[model samples]
Target: MPTLVLDTLVNAPIAIVFDLARSIDLHMYSTKKTNERAIAGITSGLIELGQTVRWRAKHLGVYQTLTVRITKMEKPYFFEDKMIQGVFQSMDHQHLFEEQEDGAILMRDVFHFRAPLGPLGRFAEWSFLTVYMKRFLEERNRIIKAVAESGDYVCYC
Candidate 1:
């Protein structure tokens, strides 16, 4: 398994950033370049703990579908989602938020995923998947930060 971690500072309230992170609508907006969509389960609105969401998207020039369940949550502080079914052997993404004294939020993402096919998968991770996934997460976080900072994230939730 390869893990990717990212930390970002957003000029927004912790609650706003947290909600935007879980908003299905904001996800779709962020992934517009990939044409990602929630096709099953919670198709819109904020995803709560224990809920499953099925997403279809085009990545690496291939159309893929992945299902994930929100396994843990702690209001505006933290949340974890795990893959139920997807291209990876296993996938887990944890989102954490901390409020700064300046009233902004420090957001962090910890993502872990294991590809299939044994050695080949490890090679892929080393050669490309790791970098690709990092960029993917960065892009998503960029959108989240932008939206949350703009104070319009409430409209998506």
Candidate 2:
């Protein structure tokens, strides 16, 4: 399993960050390159546990549809989504938000992924996906932090 953990401080309230993060449609705005569109399921409001969302997007020139559902939810604190069916063999992402001093928020992401080909998959991750994917998420975190700090509604379209 390849795991990535990233943490950042956003100049926003924990509730605001949590609310924005729990909305499935806001993901597209947060991501930098994964230009996704929510096709089905909850498009607005906080995504509750067991709620699933489908998205269609072109990743690396290949069109794909990913369906993910909330596996865990803890108010303005933590939420985890599991990939029920998607491009990867397995994917689980946990999003966390915490109140910090001076009224800022600490946001973090933890994701685990497993590929199908075993050793070949490890090799592929070492060759490409490892840093590539990590940087992708980091960039998205930056976008999310920017938007949340600005306290504006972003168009994920």
Candidate 3:
């Protein structure tokens, strides 16, 4: 299992930032490039533990679908999602948010994933998947930061 972690200091309140993050609509906006968006289930309202959401997206020019279930939920702080069934062998992502003295937020993303194959998996990771995942997560963070800093709950641009 390889773990990839990416953290960002966002210029926004913890609650607002967290709310924006949990919003699927905003996620669609942020991932315009990846063609990622929530298609069904937990589309709106507060996301709680055990809630599951279906995701559809295009990665590497191919459409990919996955259902993720919330495993942990702590208001205005941290939440985690585990893939019920997806392309990868396994996936667990946790998002954490905290407030700064200036009222901004510190957002962190931690991901753990296992390649499908065994030793060949390690080779694939070393060859491409690792870098791909890193770029994917980094791009996501960039969009999140943009959405948070924009001060608009909705991404209009």
Largest lDDT belongs to which candidate? 1
Candidate 1 lDDT over residue span 10-94, tens digit each: 9987888999999999999999989999999999999999999999999999999999999999998999999999999899999
Two-way TM-score contest, 1 vs 2, winner:
1
TM-score, candidate 2, is 0.89
Per-candidate TM equals 0.98, 0.89, 0.89
Q: What is the C-alpha RMSD of each candidate to the true structure, in Å?
A: 0.8, 2.2, 2.2
What is the Å distance of residue 137 in model 2 from its true position? 1.1
**Where is the poorest 10-residue window by lDDT in model 1?**
148-157
Q: Whose lDDT is higher: candidate 1's or candidate 2's?
A: 1
Off by over 4 Å in 3: 44-46, 154-157
lDDT (CA) for every model shown?
0.94, 0.80, 0.82
CA displacement after TM-score superposition, residue 94 of candidate 2 (Å)? 0.8
Candidate 1: list runs displaced more than 4 Å.
none
